[model samples]
Target: MVMSLGQGLWMAINAIYAVTVVHLTPGQLGVSVSVAAAIVLVCSIPLGHLADRTGPRTVQMWSFLASAPLTAALLFVSGFWTYLVVVSAQAIAYRAGRSARKAMIAGLILPADRVSVLAYVRAASNVSVSIGACLAGLVLAAGSRLGYQGAVLFTAVAFLLTGALTAREPRVPPVPATAGSALAVLRDGPFLTFTILDGLLTTHALLLDVVLPLWVLRRTDAPRWMSAIILVVNTVLVVGTQTKAARGTDTPAAAARASLQGAGCVAVACVVFAMSDEAALVPACLLLVSGALAHALGEVRQAAGSWAIAFDLAPDHAQGQYQGTHAMGADLGKMFAPAVFTWLVLEHGALGWIVLAVGFAALGTAMPAVVSRGVRMRSGSDPVISTG
Candidate 1:
C-alpha cells in the first residue's frame, strides 16, 4: 500500500511535469528521461550486489534521502542540462532501491509460485498508477508549480517511509557472491535473450510516455482533465485484467506465449492510435486502453517467465546479480526508446505513428521465438505458442 501511494505520488508529479517540462520538446525531455534511465541501469548491478552482501534497508534509506532534494529541485530548473543532472540523480537512487526491492521480493516468496506473486505486485503497481494519474490530473488542472512540486515531495516522503517500513522488517541473510560471475551470467544465452526481449517491451511502454500526451493534446477536444481520465481508464483496465490473465498461466510456456500475444495487442493498439483523429477519439481511447490492458498481460507473463527461468538458472546465492542484470535491460530500453521516439515524432508528424506500429508489430512477431528459445535453453522445454 505504501509502495502504491508512493508510486501514485511520483506518477502524478510526472504527468504534470510531462506537460510542463519533461515532454516540452520531444528531444530535451527524451534526453533527460534517457539519461536518468541510463544512470539507473549503470547503478543497478552494483547496488543489487551490495544489497545482497548487506541488507537493503540502509541502502534504501540513504538513496531516498539523497534523491529527495534532487526531485524537489526539479521545479526550479530552467535548462535541460540541470534537468538531466537532477533527474538522473533521482533515477540512480530510485533504481538502486528498486533493484534491491525486486531482489528482496524474490527472497520473501516461496519458489514454487514466485511468478504469480510477482504478478500481484505488478497489479498493485498498476492500481497505484491509476490512482496516481487521477490525482495528477487534479494537480495539473491547478496549474501551479507548487502543486506539482508538492506531489513529488510527497513521493519522496513515501520513499523515506518505505525505508522506515522496510527497516522495521527483519533483515534477510545476504546472498553470497562469487568471483567473475557477472561475466558468466552475461554469457549465459537464455538470460541474455530474456534481457533483450524485455528491453524491447520497455520500448512499447515508452509509446505511452511519448505518444499519449501528444495524442491527448493534439487529437482530442476533451479538456485537459481528459488526459488523466484516459490514464485512469488505462490503469483501471490493467489492474482489472492482470489478475485473470496471470491466473490463466498454468505453465511457464503458457506464460511466455500469453506475454507475446499481449505484445501483439499493444502493436494493434499502436496502429489504431496512429490512425485516430478528432473523429476517432473515442475509439482511439478505447484502443489505447485495450493496448494498456494487453501490455499488463504481457508484463505478467514476462515477469513470470523471466523470474522462473532466472531463479532456476541462477545458483541460490547469485539471484541478486541475476535480477540486477535483467533490470538493467529494462533500464537500457527505457533510456533508448524516448530518444528514438522523440526523433520520430519530430521528423514525421502522423507518420511517426506508422513507425511505432511497425516497430511494435515486429517486436510482437519476434517475441515468441525469442522466448521459446529462452525457455528451452533455460527451462529445457518447448515454450507454448498459444496464449491462455
Candidate 2:
C-alpha cells in the first residue's frame, strides 16, 4: 500500500509535472518515459538474478530505499536531461524490486495459497491507489509550486517508510547459483512460450485504459461520463470478484484452462464493445457496462492464472529470476499495446474489433495445448490436457 500510494502520486502527476514545472515538451517527455521503460526490460532479468544470488528481502528493501532520494530529487529537476536521468534511475530501482518482492512472497507463501492471497493483495492495492489519486487530486487543485513539491516529498517519504517496513519482514535466503544452472528460466522453452502467451493476453490492460475511453468519446453515442463509469465498474468487479475468480486454479491444467476462459471473456467483451458504436445512447451505456463487466472478470481470471503458473511451474531455487522473466513479458506487452490496439480498434472500425475478438479467442483456445506441452515437458506425460 505504501509503495502504491507513492507510485499513484507520481504516476498521476508525472506528465503534468514534466510539462508545467520542468517545461519539457510533450514529445520529449514521451521519449524519456519510454526510454526509461525500455531500460527496465533490459534490467529485470539481471536484477532478479542478483536477488537470487543475494537475499530477496535485502534486495527488495534496498530497491525501495534507492527510489526515495531519487523521487525527492524531482523537486530540483530543472531540465529534460536531469528529469530523464532521475526518472530512469528510479524506474530501474523500483521495477527491479518487483522480482525480488515476488520472490520473497514465493518463499513465504505456500503454492496453493499464492493465487488467492495475491488476489486480495491486488484488491487492497486498488483501494489504496484510489485514495492516493484523490490526494494527488487535492494537490492538483491547490496548484502551487509548494504543493507540487510537497507531493513529491510525500512520495519520497512513502518509499522510505515502505522500505523500512519491508526490512522488518523475515529475510528470505538466497538461491545459490551453480556454474551450469544460473539463469535457468531463460533455458526453459515451454515456460518462455507460456510467458509470451501470457504477455499477449495482458495487452487487454492497455485496451481497457487507453482504447476503451477513446472509443467511447469518438465512436459511440454513449455519454462522455460513461467512460469513467466503465472504469469504476471494472474496479468494483475486480475488487469484489477477483478472489472467486482465483479459486479452482491450483494446478497447471486448471490454470491454463482458466486463462483460456479469461481470453474468451475478453473476446466477448470486445464484440459487445464493437456493437456499442452503432447503438442509441441508452443502449450504448448498457453495452459499455456489459463489456466492462466481462472484461473485468476476464482481467481477474487471467491475473489469477498467471500468478498460479508463475509460482507452480517455477523451480523453487530459481524463483527470483523466473518471476522477473515472467514480468518482462508484461513490459513487452504494454509497450506494444498502444500501437497495436489504436490501429486495430480506433482506425479500422467494426472489422478491426472482430479481428481482435477472433485473435483473443484463438490465443485462449491455443493455450491449453501449450500448457499440455509444458506439462509433458516437465512430467514426461501429457497428463493435464486429457484429465483436466
Candidate 3:
C-alpha cells in the first residue's frame, strides 16, 4: 500500500510533469518509457540475483531507498536526456523492489495464505491509491509549479517511508548461490513457456486502461464519461470481490484452473464490449458496464492465480531471480500491447475485437497444459538450478 501510494501520487502528475512542465514531446516520453522497460528486461535477473545473494529484505529496502532519490531528481529534469535517464534509473529500482517483495512473500507467507493475503494487499492498494490520487488532485487543481514539485516530493517521501518499513521487517537470509550460470531461470523451457502465457493473459490490464478508451470514444455511442465510470466500477469490484476470487487457490493446479476461468471471463467481456460499438446510448452504457465488471473480476482472479503459480513453481532458493524473470515476461506483454491492440482491434474494427477475444481465450485454454508441463518438468528433473 505504501508503494502504491507513491504510485498514485506520481502517476497523477508524472506524465504532466514530463510533457507539460519539462516540455517533452509525447514521442520522446514514449521512447523514454519504452527504453526503461527494455532496460528492466535486461537488468531484472541480475538484480534479483542480488536479492538471493544478499537478502530479499535488504534488496527491497535499498531498492526503495535508491528510488526515492531518483524520483525526486525529477525536479531537476530540464531536458529529454535528463528525464529519460531519471525515469530509466527509477524503473530499474522499482522492478528490483518488486522482485524482492515477491521473494519476501514467498519466504514469509505460508503457501496456503499467500494468495489471500496478496488479495488483501491489492485491495488495500486500490483504496490507498485513490486517497493518494485525491491528495495529488488538490495540487493539480491549484496549477502551480511549486505545488507539482511538492506533490512529487510527497511521492519521494512515500518511497523513503516504504523503505524504512521494509527495513523493519524480519530478515529472511539470502539463499546460497547454486552451481551454473546466474541465468539458469532463462534456461528453464517449461517455466519460460508458462511466463509467456501468463504474460499474454496479463495484457488484460492494457485492454482495459488503453484500448477500452479508444473503443469507447471512436467505436461506441457510450457517453464520454463511461471510461471513468468503468474504471470506478473496476476498482469497486476489485476491492469487494478479490478475496472471494482468491479463495481455494492454494496450489498451482487449482491456481491454473482459476486462471483459465478468469481468462474466459475477460474474453466474454471483450465480446460484450465489441457489441457495444453500434448500440444506442443506454444499451451501450449497459454493455460497457457489464464488460467492465467481467474484466475486473478476471483481472483479480488472474492476478491471484499468477501469484500462486509463480511462487509454487519456482525453486525456493531462486524465488527472487525467478520472480524477476516472470515480471519481464509480463513487461514484454505490456510493452507490446498498445501496438498489438491498435493493429488488431482499432484498425480492423469489430473483427479485430473478435481476434483479440480469440487470442485471450486461447491464452486461457492453454494455461492448464502449460502449468502442468512446468510442474512435470520440475518434479522430474529439477531442470532449473537449485540448492537441493
Q: List the RMSD of every prediction in angstroms.
A: 4.6, 4.9, 3.8
Best by the lDDT measure: 3
TM-score of 2: 0.80
Candidate 2 Cα lDDT to native: 0.78
**lDDT (Cα atoms) of all candidates against the true structure:** 0.64, 0.78, 0.79
Q: Write the per-residue lDDT of candidate 3 for residues 56-173, one digit (tens) a residue.
A: 9999999999988998999999999999899889989999899998888888888678778888988888777656666655665576899888877888898999998887998888
Query: Tens digits of per-residue lDDT for model 2 on 116-144?
Result: 88988888776665566566666655667
Per residue, candidate 1 scores C-alpha lDDT tens digits across 76-192 of 777777777888888888776766666666677676666677767777877877777777777878868777777877776766666666667656677555433444455666666
Models 1 onward score TM values of 0.86, 0.80, 0.83
Give the candidate number with the greatest TM-score: 1
Measured with C-alpha atoms, the lDDT of residue 295 in candidate 3 is 92
Off by over 4 Å in 1: 12-24, 178-182, 248-251, 278-312, 345-350, 375-388
Query: What are the runs in model 3 whose C-alpha is more than 4 Å off?
Result: 9-31, 75-83, 133-151, 178-181, 208-229, 272-289, 342-353, 381-388
Which model is ahead, 1 or 3, in terms of lDDT? 3
